[model samples]
Target: MILNGIITGLIMGGILSLPVLGVAVIYGITGIPNFAIGVIGVFGGFLTWYFLSFNMGIAILVGVVFCFAIGYIIQRILLTPISERGGDSTLFFIVTVSLGFVFEGLMRAIFPRPSISLALPRIGTINIAGVTVEGFKIFALLFALGTLVIIRLLEEHTEIGKSWQATSQNLKLAKLIGIKTNRVFSIASGIGCALACVGAIFWGSLYNLNLMTGWDLGFLGFIIAVVGGIGNIWGGIISALIMGMVMSFSGYLLGGMWQSVILYFIVILVLIVAPKGILGSERSL
Candidate 1:
């Protein structure tokens, strides 16, 4: 039972890490709290489901592309104008939050009915040390990791990645150095939303999905980011795993209701003791 719990926790953590990392990356790069990330993810999942009649891979690809476009357009149309006007972070943050609701409403309108469980195509289950594991869970974990690796590689080897790093480190300095800050912001935001889509794919495969699916997950992702150190991708990933383990164990031992209570407790404890998070710096918040 313990081993099963651990493995399940890891799987859940891996599933969750994508969105947490996305939130971290966007926050790190733009200093804007993208409250709409999860809703975007929800939209992606719904898009995939809508197109499931076609090839699954193609459906996923389309979903990803759609999310990327959404992110890019939002940044280009709304955020860019606001930022250029010297809007405060608080205002931008509220706008992002409002964007989440807007996406949620859009999703609700598009997917009027609750969907049946949309499981991804999978082989079969595997038994490891007397514990039965879903084959798709392993695939989902690998896919998530692969997505992260791809992002890391892009950041390391691509010009866009360099621009992202520069903008993240110092946006004004990046602009001064002739970096196209607006373009970099749009690309980064697009990538972040794409990451959220990846997360939504795995999540939708694992559970019953609905328009509201992203709400709680978004909140959880935010918590994971804060606990792991906001704006730290690696930190968010590690912290998500830890939180996944804790949530799994708590759900098993206490109950579903207690899981949120315990998680919130951990968040409070972490904030009081180490507000910067496990891997975050003094300026992380």
Candidate 2:
């Protein structure tokens, strides 16, 4: 039973890490706590379901495009103006939170039903070590790890990624050095949204889709970001895995309701011990 719980938690942690990484990326670059991250993900899942009849690949592609567009639009139309007016981080945070609520309402209107299920094409199950795991769960983990590797490679080898790193390090200096900070922000937002879309698809495959799914993911992602150290993508991933283990153990030993209680308690203890998170830097927002 313990081993089973651990395996399940690890799989779930992989899926949950997707959105948390997205949040970390956006926060690292733009210093905005994008509360609407999950909403964008939920929207993508809905798009996948809407277009599932055509082709799964096409559905996923459309969802990614839609999420990218939404993120870009939000950054360009709303966030840009606010930033130009000298909005602080607090203001940016409030704006994002408000946007999250607005998007949630829009989602509720579009998906008025209580719940909907959109299962991925099953690849059956596989036995690993003595435990049986769903094939889709393996796919989701590999997909997430692959995506992270790609992002890391881009950050190391690409001019665009270098610019992002520079901007993240010092926005004023980046602007002075002729790096188009606004464009970088927009691109970061798009990339984050794309990641969120991927997470949404994987999550939708595992469970029923509902309006609240986005909120749940976004909130949890936020916690994971804080726990992993906001603006540290790798830290977020590691923290997510740790959280998964804790959640799994707590759920197994105690009860389902106690899972969150224990998780939050651990987070508080971590914060008290290391306010900057396990791998977080002093500059982490």
**Per-residue lDDT over 68-95 for candidate 1, one digit per residue giving the tens place of the 0 to 100 score:** 9998889888887887898887998799
The lDDT for every candidate, in the order shown, is 0.83, 0.84
TM-score of 2: 0.95
Q: Please list the residue runs of candidate 1 whose C-alpha ends up more than 4 Å from where it truly belongs after superposition.
A: 281-285
Q: Assess the local accuracy of residue 200 in candidate 1 as a C-alpha lDDT between 0 and 100.
A: 87
**Candidate 1, lDDT over the whole model:** 0.83
How good is model 1 by TM-score?
Answer: 0.94
Residues 1-285, candidate 2: write the lDDT tens digits.
878888878878888888987898888888777888898888888888888889989988999999988888898888877877889878877888788888778777876465777767999999988899989888888887787788888888999888988888998999999999998889888888888888888888897778888888888887888888888878888888889888888988998899999999999999899788888843322
Against the hidden reference, what TM-scores do the models get? Answer: 0.94, 0.95
Predicted model with the maximum TM-score:
2
